[model samples]
Target: MPLIRYRTGDLGRLLTEPCGCGSQFCRLDRVKGRIAFRSALPSVYDLEELLYGMDTVLDFSARKEENKLCIQVLLAEGGTIGPVREAIEARFPDALVSVSSTLCLVSTGKQLIN
Candidate 1:
């Protein structure tokens, strides 16, 4: 047997604080969302799975603005935006996430004046 180097792409939080149960080992928080890899964001299908899978995500459209990645989404009723932002930011730190009712599309579909 060997130590597998496979990445599960499962997103979770590392808990450093001591627990009340007196467990010595650090705990891994429940899975929040998933990404493609540790160094890069997920693929289109993976992004779809990650976004649409969330209860907060109702509709979405992605576009690349130079080095910036943007995802505009519509949320379900009473769904807070924090979790949606976190789910995206946690996986793709480079993304400039903006969740709003407005879905804007560039006419040229290209970065102008860049």
Candidate 2:
């Protein structure tokens, strides 16, 4: 096989440092966003990582409404809303986070936004 560079549209960092497990091979950091979603502002990939990092969030979608960001989330059973709202606020100071039982999905069944 020949070496080729392919664009996967994922945005992330490459780690050069050895891992705590003692592996020296470089590792790609968590994907931050897709190239198609690139913009002058913070990438939605970062926000997705933050929301999904929470144990309760089952799914989520985010959109810009006027001057504020609206985040709708689906929670796991017995999930609480406070933490999700806090995480989004902390990361995006100006955003308005809303917790919901359902979020719209595309035809492919993926969450509509990031």
Candidate 3:
């Protein structure tokens, strides 16, 4: 199927100027950003940055269970989930964050917000 005048959900600017090497193809500029990934929550990339930036987190999953937000994590160096849960709760005050084993519930293979 062909899509015409469609929003690709990508964040960038189209460059129509000819290339210095005489190429006629146009290109897009660096990512300006996209529309809000999820209306009720932050974007996946943002969450990834937040989690991955921490030292103790080896891997994680941001998911929901029993009508609340839960984060499952694999810790490194025998780290504790208490700090992680507290950090997340601090960021999302109203969210009910819980700790779970690495067995996370994933739908559509991405963070299930909203």
Candidate 4:
């Protein structure tokens, strides 16, 4: 199935001009940036679905020193880290999940503190 354009609760102004990509869909010139990606949490899904969602997941793939289940995220303002951690643990009870703030070098990397 073709991907349809839908609002993602991301509020931002739209560009009146058409995109260079040649799509007629109203393009958003500016939206959230990498900084917003620092506080994202994991979801309840199998690895297959998680991988599928990673296309829109920011900074999803990153290098890590420790071995653990990691999930990179870009969260909206006022979003708390606790709920995200809870969701992940509830979804995958067997897996140990941990949280960490964004690192300057890593930018928006996630490391599941095993």
Best by lDDT: 2
* Off by more than 4 A, model 2: 1-40
Residue pairs in clash, model 3: none
lDDT of 4 by residue, 52-107 (tens): 34333332222222433455444345555466556545654533433334422322
Model 3 spans with C-alpha error above 4 angstroms:
1-39, 105-114
Candidate that beats the other on lDDT, 3 or 4, i.e. the better one: 3
What is the C-alpha lDDT profile of model 2 across 32-82, one tens digit per residue?
453232243555556667987999998877766666666788999999989
Q: How high a TM-score does candidate 4 get?
A: 0.29
Global CA lDDT computed for model 1? 0.63
Worst 10 residues of 1 by lDDT: 1-10
lDDT of each: 0.63, 0.68, 0.56, 0.38
Q: Write the per-residue lDDT of candidate 3 for residues 1-114, one digit (tens) a residue.
A: 222222223245567889889989976554433223234445444555677888988766555454455556667877887887777777755555544456443453533333
Ordered by TM-score, highest first, the candidates read 2, 1, 3, 4
Better by lDDT, candidate 3 or 1: 1
Estimate TM-scores for all models: 0.53, 0.64, 0.50, 0.29
What are the per-model numbers of colliding residue pairs?
A: 0, 1, 0, 1
